[model samples]
Target: MGHSRFRRSIVHVNATLARVVGDEEGMSTAEYAIGTIAAAAFGAILYTVVTGDNIVSALTGIIGKALNTSVG
Candidate 1:
């Protein structure tokens, strides 16, 4: 009797786990949310670096050099 009860409990637990594992209702939404947050963070970092004074000066210097070059 105890053996039978233990087997039933194991089966019940397995069934519950299977149901939980098979359910993927909000997985896509969660993945999309994480991806969006990562993208936003990356964009913010890129914007900050590009808008910094050092980058601005480097870009300005490169442009000045390009414009000052003469065509032979």
Candidate 2:
């Protein structure tokens, strides 16, 4: 009788814990939010890699040429 009661109590505790863990009220939303933040960070890094310093230098040179041509 004592062993059976102990086993039943353990089973009950396990079931309750499983129920709480399986309840997904906020887990999916948090996952999506994290994914969005990661994607934005990746995009910013890619943009910096692709066009940052070169684009700035190119624009600066074009502006300098335009000013020199127009003034002289």
Candidate 3:
């Protein structure tokens, strides 16, 4: 009895999975290409900003202060 029940449950699960996966859709290659380009452009801009003098100096100051803090 348990063995037959297990077989029926597995069959039902497979049918449900097939139905769900058959109807699902996702982005194609062109969309992926556009997303990749956008991400690279954003990374370039972020790198330029972070490497600028003002941000560098600010980060240096913060790290210096943290390192110089006294402990009891």
lDDT (10s digit) by residue, model 3, range 1-72: 255774575565556545544554785666556556655655665576679898899999999999999998
Point out the higher-scoring one by TM-score: 1 or 3. Answer: 1
List candidate 3 segments past 4 Å from native.
Answer: 1-26
Compute the lDDT of residue 45 as modeled in candidate 3. 55
Instruction: Give model 1's TM-score versus the native structure.
Output: 0.57
User: What is candidate 2's lDDT per residue for 1-72, written digit by digit as tens?
Assistant: 255774575565556445545565766666556555655655665566457687689889999898889543
Model 2, position 32, has a per-residue lDDT of: 54
For model 1, the superposed segments whose C-alpha errors exceed 4 Å read 1-26
Q: Which residue pairs of candidate 2 clash?
A: none
Report lDDT per candidate: 0.66, 0.62, 0.65
All candidates: CA RMSD in angstroms? 20.4, 22.4, 18.6
* Residue 60 of model 1, lDDT score: 100
Worst 10 residues of 2 by lDDT: 12-21
- lDDT (Cα, tens digit) per residue for candidate 1, span 1-72: 255774575565556445544565765666556555655655665577679898899999999999999999
Q: List TM-scores for all candidates, in order.
A: 0.57, 0.36, 0.53
